[model samples]
Target: MCNGQRTEPCNVFPKNQYIEVGSSTEVVCQTTCVRGRVFWTLDNSPIDESLSRTINSSHTVLTLRNFTHHSATLQCHSADTQQVLGGTTIRTYSKPSKISCMLESENQHGGVPEWVKCNWEHQIISPLKINYTLIYEMPLKPKTELCHSQETNCSNKSSSGPIYMFTNATFTVRAKTTAWETSSDPYEIDPYSMYKIIPPKVKVTVLPDRLSVKWSRSGTYRICHCEVKYSKVVSDGTPEVVLKKTLGANESIGSATIENVESCTNYKISVRCAIDKAPWSNWSQEQMVLTKLNKRHVRLRLWRKIAAPEESEMRKVHAMWKEIPSTCQDTFTYTIKTTPYKDDVPGVNYTDISCDNSTCDFDVSHHAHRISLKAFQKGILLAEDSVYVPATGKSLPQVTGIQASPLGDVILVSWKAPVQPVSGYMIDWTHNGHQYYWKESKYTNTTLSGLLDKKRYNITVTPLFEDKTGRGTQAIHICSRVGDPGNVTITVDPNDKSVFVSWDTKSQEECSGTVINYTVFYGTQTGPMLNVTVDGTRQGIHLKDLSPDTQYRVYVKATSLTGTNRSSERLFKTKRFDPRLLLALSVCGSIIIILVLSLGLFCAIKWKKFSEKPVPNPGLSSVALWTSPSHQKGKGSFQPFDNPSESLFDQIYTEATQKTSTSPLATSYNSNPAGGQTEEYTEAATVVAPEEQNEKPVGQRLCSPGESTALLSSEKGKHSPYRSQSSVESPTSMSNKLCKRVPVKQLEKSTPVTVYVTLDMFEQGQSR
Candidate 1:
């Protein structure tokens, strides 16, 4: 290899040459020694052997085809010994094109040009240095070389003294190298037509119904034209309404008046000028000015901060406002008048605060406050504005998807629109704990400029409604990055043996360079470390197949164009069970328990009713009243009435017997008012057959008026001709007692029967 250095010569001809780019050339390699052979190389790389041919035993010709390189060195070597023989340098060149020139003048009073700069465009760059000369011709002078340099651009810088304006001039650029020279097409124009005017310094004065603008003359030319542009300044991302007026020429300080401007409003004003038919100059730096307001009428956007109530129920109200631009000649002071609100109604008593600046702090009761501020000059009120502040602001939906990015020298913040109705948004930012800057935007995004580099800033965006302000979302940002990101969060999902890892990555604007990748590092307490890699776009990742019920440490590392950053380590434990499954089991167990308790209660109630004896209803049987011991003398001592015809049982039996007398098999004995037979008497009465009746002795009846009477049989659904005989004797005069016996059947054949007797006639006889 040649190593790009010169070597001993082998008699190469045409040693140095300059060729146009993309053109071909040829060189000869020769040696005085007989039968010598050689090879060629370009830029230390072997050239194709087919491009070279032997002219004789001691000479060779090397051909370069389609030479496209800007510069290269060609070397020849001895074929047999491979020894370097000779080398030559070849370079490509391109003629400069599209040459242009412009005259520059910065004098507010401009007649002569300050300097002239001429430049040319080159399609291909050349490695060899090229010299450029600016040639120009004045209106009445011969052509001259204005400036010379080894760069594409050359400036006169008053090298030929001051050039007169308003006259024609010709400009041309000449480019030359060691082996080639060329000149661009001549460009001609009047110096005044090409000259650029300097923007004028502008100042504004407030007028009662207009704005007076004055600007220093841009140039000495009398035919110059100047325009003053002014617009109202608004904060809500609204386009300004610009108004322009022409300034008079020939004046050292040109002046223009904008009529019918708003009262007490901020305006942005700028000025630009042009001489004759030349292009207008760039606009001057914008200036903020306020228009005069009518006395006693002022508009102000007022805001307040209310601190938490003290133990005495008094809250501190810090009221602030933007400094008002004063146009009045008299000095003024701000008066803060506050009225406590009772259910949103202004109170009768008003409190006044003495203030001289844009802010005032005072104590107020725990009530809504109605505050008003007035500007007073020498005891006369010049302007007044009021604002109503509630104890608690209305809650509104917040913006979503907030993002902050750097764009050039400014930071841009954007967010998704909120769910609630909104009129605009308020954007506020602060560096450190100092005063904050605020702006209003009707758009979803806004730009925040003029930030200090490498410092952290807190930016907050709050939504605004027609009647209230919403809560704000805050974001920490740095205009310039000082270090790598260091915040990470981890969550464990035990059921799936996984964990979720998330991290905060600074935006490209906040970082020194773009972020390219992210890595999550995790490990169990005593296990080997594991890692998962993902791209920078992914903010979170799920690390699966982890050991449950184990402690693990995790962290995230970010790789960016600037460098790598690793977050602090965090420890977390995986749960033993799935929370969702546990919750479901608990709910199911509670339901099952409730169901079991309810069923058990129902069964207990049913079994009690099934196992207990059924008591007959007293209203149907009269057994409770008749079977009492007070009505009985002894066992079977109760007696029937002496006259069977007057007895209620005898009457019912006689009536039932007469009716069923025609049907010997009749088994029903019922007394019902609705003409329907009642089954309640079925077990209470028994019918006697005619044969049984005839068998009774004439003087010995089964139940005498003093003996007990039993009307029912011992078997259910069975009748017998034998009478229920009662042998107990009652010696008392029971003939006066009007008593009746109600028969009750036994539940089982082996159960003894009881005869109950009611003393209805005894009570009636005693009353008589």
Candidate 2:
């Protein structure tokens, strides 16, 4: 020990502790020291010679490696001071312990088709007790367990009796121990429950064309694999392997191909499923499948009969069938019947028949086939025919030739009979079907004549027999030939108030006798008879006179033994005066006279104006008339008279000057005013002026007074005949009256008056 240090008491324990032979125990040593060495000794002796104890941080540890049931002492002390801190002594005993575990059994037992075993064991000290509990479950029942405690009469006197029984399916065993009411460590037993696991239930389904199989398992089990087997049955009652297949777990349904199998064939199939970690299940129940038969089995059959008598005709038949076997039965049968038929029969020959189990037959020739037969089924009758004869006597007679000839009051007809020889031949002739007659023709050709003109006839040749008149064959209806009317010669005679018309007739062999009477039809236009005459054997006749300029159409018909023949029409035109021609000539003559009068009048007026103008002086007047020399002179002379009074006087004087100067008498007046008052003298002067002017030389000016008066009078007559005439007449009167009052010298010296006259005369005369 040292100062400022603390010491603690050490723990003392027996050196040896009693323990069961088959059990385990624990020993402990504890001590506290202060800065000192501590050690444990056995029986007051140091356990180890060298440093059995070592200084530690305020504590000490002791260890004993071995222990025995033999009594042994132990001491704890400080090594340096040699003082004992603790000591203990004990006696040791060993007893066999009961071994226990968490699990009641060590070995589990259960098996499918075999027995399984389970066992357990435990070890414990003599004073300790062991308890065991076993839990388990079965496939069809829930889990349950049993508990057994040593206190509950579980024996230690005898080795624990074997606790053997059928454990629950879900087995879980555990065991625990207690010594003198102290609990021991618990132990668990491995789960070792046994069970017979069923793999799964497999279901199988078979289809008409295929097979399907499925299966499932319980409790997290999966089908890992599967196998299928199928069989096909033969006609001999033996089954053969048709398909076999093994499939993995991933595959649930398996298929096998079997092609070209007979229709309606039956098959058997089975399937089994194997689960993961489990045996395979039993095969599922067998399933059967039948293949469908072919659907294209219905068809139609037909037959026909050929040779048959006229009274008994041909026949037709019909039948139908299917190819299936099940539909065909022994009870199926067929029959057919028919009606009477005459000529063309049905094209098909078979008759309808009753259908039974899969087979039928129809008779086509019994009477006539009426119904249609179907194989393996009842037949339906659609139609039938009855026995009848086709109409006979179809052959017709042939007509070879026909002819016509005229007879007395009759037409003779004949036709050639058939060369092939018919029963008989009938000949008939009709006139527009109104009159007809029949005759027998034995010859190859016949003739029919004496037919009227413009008449139609139908002739038919038919074969005839005793039984009945055979149908008309090769018949032809035709008009017979008509004899031409005789050529007629007509004569006409005109009288004072009447005319005579007659005609002659020609001989015709078709006539029955001589001409009986003559018929005369006359009108402006040829039409139906307006007048008829009956004359017996007379060739000439007379028709009274008709009005002149009239037209007449006459037709004569000659009566004969057969009929009357009409002659060609004779159209007569009468002679008479025509007023239209005279009227046309008169109109033409009047138009020509009017045209001639209009032309003559125009010429007269033109000549009158020409005669009034006095011929100018050939030299100066030619210049004045050809050029505009007078216009210049007149303009210059008028310019000096610009005053209004002078202008008026100038206009009047200029007009008077123009009139007096251009006149024929203008120059004559300059010759003698006394002579101008006489027509003869004026005429002579007018004639002499031009003769005197013509004598002057071409360039020399004529006498001015004569030239100026002639120019003025000529201009006045041309532009203003009224003014010129008034001026000329005024001068003539004044000259006649004032001859005595004026001096001859003044009258002679002053400008002489010139009379200008325009002579115009109209005359009416008929030329031709």
Candidate 3:
């Protein structure tokens, strides 16, 4: 820093060289000079005097409320020094925008746009981390690619190639930066006037050994002349003869003839066009043509006769050949003739046979034979073949020891081969109405399937002689039944108390005859047997209503046309119920019920006794009553009834009778209506000996009627709440007169004169 007194010093605030728009900042310029005067300017222009500015000591402050266009260079100067002291360009770094792109014609022919050139303008920075993505769009397809370039001399790759073209296609370029992206409008170039000429169309027709080709130009390109190149490629590396033909200018369509083309040969023909002198339109797309194929003569090749196992005395021979069909085709027959070497049998010496197909088979006689084959087409002999058959001294092997083992469901048939070597053996079997044949077998044993389970079958095996040269040629036959069916499956229905039985059937090979039906037998361990029949198509049957909780043995038998076989029986136990336990529980419950009832009965008896009111003890309850208006009291003997009918007297009498120790006391209670007198008395029945009681008192007064108060001695210690033991006071009865004391003895002495008492006498009195 220099002192303005001798040298000037100028400075500016906002030391940052860059600022963003829409931001407020304070700029200050300071200068030490002869006078304290400083000012600020933008972009080398003097600041507006009207704009807000402050004056300080040797410094000026300029307040920029906000930066609108911040790309200005801020300048600070001293008025006294008359020079600029400092300046800075405040880089705003706005986002990129306003992009533009166009196609360059550098690599193009006339009026053709080739390479993609793009132009973009940005306010922020040039050569900015700018990446351009170009979108090339065409009908039905749009492809995108990325490129990086600055604002100048930037263009994409050329579109003049076949796969890539600008015609009818538009390109859009977009620029991307760390901050923003902007895309330019789309641009396209028309290729109609461009130099790229579309390939012409070619038509072809084929004839015998020749191809006729016609070519025509497409689009608006005028051709001065056209050349057609015709050639065919061949093996052996030799150049094929190529024919070329030229046509005059203005001839858009022309025909060329290619002759001498071998049958079945393919040829390629192409035509190219030339403008007034421009490059020949890329050879008009090549056209391919083919001539018709020609058929030729036939050839026959016969294979040597190989011995077959299943053939009779004659050896089997096969002949095969190929024949090329002629253009004018006709049916042909392959003929074979067998000529025996020995010529023994007249008819078998020379046997000629013919077939309508391509292959022919001949059976040579027992001896060494000669075979001849010929192929004839349209009555013309095209080829012939001869085969010589040699006979071996050995004969066909004898099939012996043929046996069949019933292997559960399948039947295994095995045989022993004859000691002498033979070609092979054949086995044939019929099962379940189906016939099966096996020939040319290499193994000694074979297994058969689809047999009826546990059924019988018969199968036969024969050792075949290829040339009838064997001494013994008897076939081995065996008849046997299939093994028992597979294990019987037992299913028990717990709810229905039934069992279901099932088994697998024998294989077809084991039992070839029809399986009539299946019989299922089931029963409990100690019960009668039960059986069910199932049809041939069914293998299982359900037996319902069977005993529950029982053990059973079950077996399944399948019967075929041959015979019936049985499966192993299965032992099954049904569910069990414990009757003893249930009976014990019932008895216990009954016993408990009986005990409860007994206790209830006992309580009822006690309650009945307690509910009863004690009939005043006969001895204690005593009273007197008059019999009639005469105020006379009568008495009668009280007889005890063994059965009383709801009465207190009967209760007292019965009580007295039961207690013999107590005095045999009886009380008769009676009441009279007229006197309203009630009388009651207790009598002691003393069966005295004749001397004890000489007389009985008929009527006795224990208390005088005048003594209204009937006094009783409490010394007895017996009482009824109704009557006081001391005395019962009441009005004296009118029958106060004394009654005669007639002795019972005198009465009886007189009553021996027969005194009769009736049931009406006891009904005379009433008691309250």
Best by lDDT: 1
TM-score of every candidate relative to the true structure: 0.42, 0.22, 0.25
- Quick one: how many clashes does candidate 3 have? 21
Question: Candidate 3: where is the Cα deviation over 4 Å?
Answer: 1-170, 173-331, 340-352, 359-363, 379-381, 386-768
Give the C-alpha lDDT of model 3: 0.52
Over 345-400, each residue of candidate 3 has an lDDT whose tens digit, in order, gives: 56644656877655566566556666677876577775786644556554444677
Clashes of each: 4, 93, 21
Full candidate order by lDDT, most accurate first: 1, 3, 2
For model 1, the local distance difference test gives: 0.64
How would you order the candidates by TM-score, starting with the best?
1, 3, 2
Q: Which lDDT tens digits does candidate 2 get at residues 1-768?
A: 222234564555544354333343333344453335666676655666342333345444454444553545766666677666666664333322233221222222212222223334343334334455544444565544443454422312112232223442333445444422222222222222222233334455444344455554332222345555666655655555534444554564444454444445566656554444344445666766665443232232222222233344323222222324452232323333343343335564433444442223323343322343333333332222121112233354455555555444345555556555565665656565434455555555455545565344666666554432433433343334444456566766544334577787764433223466788777766444467677756776666645667677777877665467777778776546444566798999999999999999999999999988653332332111111233435642211211222111111122122212334533322344554442221111121112122232211122223333454565553332123222332343333321111111112233333322332211123121
lDDT of each: 0.64, 0.43, 0.52
TM-score of candidate 1 to 2 decimals: 0.42
Question: Could you tell me which 10 consecutive residues in candidate 2 have the lowest summed lDDT?
Answer: 737-746
Q: Find the number of clashing residue pairs for candidate 2.
A: 93
